[model samples]
Target: MSTEESPVEREDRWVLNLRGMSVTKITVDFRLMLFLDSDWEVAFDASVDLSYGTAHANPSVLLSPESQGVAGALALFGANVVSAVAFKSGTLRLVFDNGHHLTCSPDPSFEAWQVTGPRRWHFASLPGGDLAVWTGSGASES
Candidate 1:
């Protein structure tokens, strides 16, 4: 589909404005889930990179439960999101006010990450690198 054909639709990439939303809860089972202020829930199945406490000077910590450094993700608890952006290639980048930055990329053969938010807005990184998005209203889908 094309934007000209549907004004409410987005191309392949989009940004999520999650500023001011704090991480209220963190859950780790088969996947890592971060709840934001009771409004948004983000789940990551693929590897995630977390940069905390001097972002530019320090290397990001990998937070894949199957691997080491997953515990570093806990630092995000109660941290407010300063900016969140989703790339067309299925990358979710989130910057936190506490000098933390998180990035989740899509997996080649599996759904990597997803987010559910207020007003029934839902977005996911599909297997093989694509985006699937749904919103409560046509206006919000963009």
Candidate 2:
């Protein structure tokens, strides 16, 4: 075999890296705020779903900030995120190490979700159902 080094493959689909980052804080008010350990925060005013693994796959959908659905996300406090991904279609999904999953879809009229992270990285779901992504280096719209 020839000795050669290959370039590291970049992840084009994933917008945020939450793996191994625990949820440090959660604020439920007019909007939802999920704070990660490493200066990462996600805020959204749109509907969100929390699925509790296979045994309880279907959980109540959070429609508004006053719906008391905050109880579901409370379980994630201090829970480490196993995976977090954002699709090109402006859909966001987060999987916790506790086997719970959270999802947020784009809103037609309002901005669905926004994720801000370290190094000035910002990703958001546009009002028209598109994505506005800004990396540490530059900004890219999708």
Candidate 3:
């Protein structure tokens, strides 16, 4: 066997727009993290969160805190994800494992989650590409 190294593909943060992305996996922890591939990763770290108007239209989707146990967060997982859409109102739409579709609106007063209480909501690749996250801490119980 020949010894060789393959290049790792990475997206430039300065030019990435996460909309319409086909996410392979997701993990819940200090951040709502997404793995574009084995080597490309992006996340919504709550510590530096800028958006906080999180609202949940459905709980079964990516915003399922009931499914992500804080005591044992490592077990949390997501497969076959669709990055969906983002609205100026701060609502982000997504499709998670098992075809769960949800819209999240991050409100700072809702005990607003960040990885710091956070979730990977949407990333828009526009004139000045943008990224958004929702709180993973206070998922709507209703």
| Most TM-score-accurate candidate | 2
User: In candidate 2, what are the lDDT values of residues 11-42, reduced to their tens digit?
Assistant: 54553567788989999887889999868898
Superposed model 2: Cα runs more than 4 Å off: 1-12, 55-60, 66-68
Best-to-worst ranking by TM-score: 2, 1, 3
For model 1, how does the per-residue alpha-carbon lDDT over 6-30 read when each residue is reduced to its tens digit?
A: 1133365676757788899998887
| Candidate 1 CA-lDDT value | 0.76
> Who wins the lDDT comparison?
1
Which 10-residue window in model 3 sums to the lowest lDDT? 1-10
> Which is the better candidate, 1 or 3, if ranked by TM-score?
1
- When summed lDDT is taken over every stretch of 10 residues in candidate 2, the lowest stretch is 1-10
**How does candidate 2 score on lDDT?**
0.75
Model 2 TM-score (2 dp): 0.82
TM-score of each: 0.81, 0.82, 0.36
User: What is the lDDT for 45 in model 1?
Assistant: 89
Model 1 alpha-carbon miss at residue 94, Å: 0.6
- Tell me the lDDT of candidate 3: 0.35
Q: Which segments of candidate 3 are over 4 A away from where they belong?
A: 1-21, 37-78, 109-142
Counted clashes in each candidate structure: 0, 0, 19
lDDT of 2 at 60: 47
